[model samples]
Target: MTLQLEDEQAQKLPFDYEELAKQVIDQVLGMEECPYESEVSLTLTDNTKIRQLNREFRKIDKPTDVLSFPLVDFQKPADYDLLESDGWEVYFNPESGELMLGDIVISIERASEQAREYGHSLKREYAFLIAHSMLHLLGYDHMISEEAAVMEQKQAAVLKKLNITREGE
Candidate 1:
């Protein structure tokens, strides 16, 4: 998997963010008949940049922890079909020769805040966010009650599998 990270604000994380992100992405991709070769872009920024993005894209006018921009529509089965099919519309990035999944934007500042607020290490919080955003890129959402349950379960399962506990174990 190709994870292009654009880290805007460099802060000392508990572990290497790139390696952790790749692991989370691998876990997500391994859950299904996924592509062995794919790409996803991640941007780590401050609250100010994320807030501007939130205001511009979501019109929220406030910074959120993370944002996901999926390349395909989740509701359609064709989205998955294209992954196996080698057609022109396979979401390929010719420049990198990898299937483009989507983009994830995360705010380090917000993640740190959330970690403290939730009584966890920043590493666990960042891993959770990366896992959560990876799922979102793979067509998971918590917009509704049922969907929220599924997503929450998936997130928890991933975290548990990775041993990224809430207590920072």
Candidate 2:
């Protein structure tokens, strides 16, 4: 997997880019059994930019910590079928022979605030958010109770592997 990271904010994050990206990639690939290569774009922005994105894409005028835009439409199997029938045109990345996973936008300001609120290091908070967003990229949704429980469990397991603990845990 290849992760292209970009930071638009001037804030000094606790984790380095390579370490954070590796953790996210490990979480995403470990949860899924796929032979195909994958790629994702991670952009760290400020509150204002994220707010604009939230309002424009999600129709919510507030800034959120992270937002994921999946490239592969996993909502319907028919969409996958359509792409498959077209000789897998949509899944392949020309340069790396990887599937374009999608983009993840994170608000550095929000993450910092959340770290303080959660009583955790900024690195742990960033890793958690990145893991959550990576799951979303891989078609994991928390819209339903059961689905959310399962997703949360998977996320916790990944975090635990990286020696990150949740509050009071």
Return the top candidate by TM-score: 1
User: In candidate 1, what are the lDDT values of residues 46-107, reduced to their tens digit?
Assistant: 89999999999999999899998988665542247646555545577887778788999999
Residue 2 deviation, candidate 1, in Å? 0.7
lDDT accuracy of residue 5 in candidate 1: 87
Estimate TM-scores for all models.
Answer: 0.91, 0.89
State, as a TM-score between 0 and 1, how close model 1 is to the true structure.
Answer: 0.91
Off by over 4 Å in 2: 75-87, 167-169
Q: Superposing all C-alpha atoms, what RMSD in Å does each candidate have to the true structure?
A: 2.1, 2.8
Superpose all Cα atoms of candidate 2 onto the true structure and report the RMSD in Å to 1 decimal: 2.8
Q: What tens-digit string does per-residue lDDT give for candidate 2 at 44-119?
A: 9999999999999999999999999988766641133444565566677987788887899999899999988988
Q: What is the lDDT of residue 10 in candidate 1?
A: 72
